[model samples]
Target: MRVGAHVSISSSKATSDSVTPPHENIANAVFRQKEVGGNCGQIFTHSPQVWKHQEITDEDAATFREETEAELDGPWVIHSSYLVNLCTPKDGLREKSIDSMQKEVDAAARLGVEYVNVHLGAHTGAGVEQGLENAASALDELDVPDGVTVLVESDAGSGTKLGGDFEHLATVIEKADLDIDVCLDTAHAFAAGYDLSTAEGVDDTVAAFDDEIGLEHLKCVHLNDSKHECGTNKDEHAHIGEGYIGEDGMNAFVNHPDLAEVPLVLETPNEAEKGFEWDIARVKELREN
Candidate 1:
């Protein structure tokens, strides 16, 4: 039942050499999150280094743990970089994707992060089925750290991206041969033609997910409202209750008994203006009403 946003410590206020390491700032950010009334938080482990190029020393890992456990009160999650594209047909990109995923798994294990969430990428002209298999193949090459789990994020289905629908995600999970899970984005699901705006549509969508990927495998929920209309295949994110998915759709998903205990993260716009305190309160309001 923890809730928070992707807070950046290293990137927030710094220069090339002047910037603090990710672990330092993230630990402090966790304290800020708690002050802002968040029960848990998410942070990135390192800078934009390519998977193979990035390096973390043992001292840095020890520092990160000490800072986080001292500053934060709950679980912490890590988000993989956007640069990774497992579905790319090209050999170089596929190799990089697999390497990056493995690096993330290692980093998460070092930092004690329980889950690493990643997106299914666009397939270009490779077609959905091929793209899914490519994604699964890349996953097969990466080792799942003992304490960490990998979760594929549902995309908006824009362009040639895979994982916009339950069937595509199910295929990737089934073919991956890895202990993978899912992170459902309400806006993405609605935009990808899941029809979560209505009661029946929401029920149908949930049922499909249960049958296709197994609801038990759902590890996290990204609570976002869509700026585009349902089935638009767009990925614009709006604030809660202010966009297409609106209050009704989000309410049902957040309050569903099956997901009541899972962590919910907000990736909405205008948090600096509206504040996560208010945003999370709004989500709490919807859950109550």
Candidate 2:
């Protein structure tokens, strides 16, 4: 099973014997993943809150690629900025979202990362159909690099956010001119009313996904446990097997035959005592051969 966590790429001096000195480059993401016993993972090229383009030097890009290939069984994904609202009705916000996404895809190409993940943000007054159209149009504007594919992540369905339903994802893929894929966030899907807290629920959700959005489009899974109940539309992630989607649900999810090939990148909280390392190990333990 390919599994990992979202790791930071910031520079820091050596803190302890167990920790390596963080270099002032993106390659530190790879090192951080290795330290946490992850084989594949996700990274933010820049701060996710702000709309900042990644200024990766050629040297840093080269180093990142070399280190990733040599040290990890990787299909690293670059998570786009939080402010990128492809579903926005306003022109200025839509244009900025497109620009931010383009930079993210280019950065993914430079870093040899295969996927660039983004959310189809809140529609903000536009109806569901118009929101889907806006999202597809925004995605069509990007000149995506070769080997770098854009993945629209499933949302928690709060307010007017798109991608909450499998239908929204399928609609965007049908409407978009650009070739794209989907990343199913477990917590988000559960929150969006697709129950995944038991083996039967997981099976039902997988079948629904296959029926609405083809299984072929699922390239990755944002493996997480939800803090809220099913259909709550909340997005807080909890430790594996310790949330509403308990041990039974997570076991079913990780070991599902249909999802066997998809990479699992965890965005679980980094709290004391149980962080990415512990989460990754727990996932491995849950996987049945």
Model 1: residues >4 Å from true position, as ranges?
A: 14-23, 47-60, 66-74
Reference-based TM-score of each model: 0.88, 0.97
lDDT of each: 0.77, 0.92
Top candidate by lDDT: 2
**Candidate 2: lDDT over CA atoms?**
0.92
Worst lDDT 10-window in candidate 1: 14-23
Candidate 1 lDDT over 118-233, as tens digits, reads: 88887989988899999998988998879899989998898988889888888988898898999888888888988876666778888989998999888888878889998999
Model 1: how far is 203 from its true place, Å? Answer: 2.1
Candidate 1 accuracy as lDDT: 0.77
TM-score of 2: 0.97
Location of the lowest summed lDDT over 10 successive residues in candidate 2: 13-22
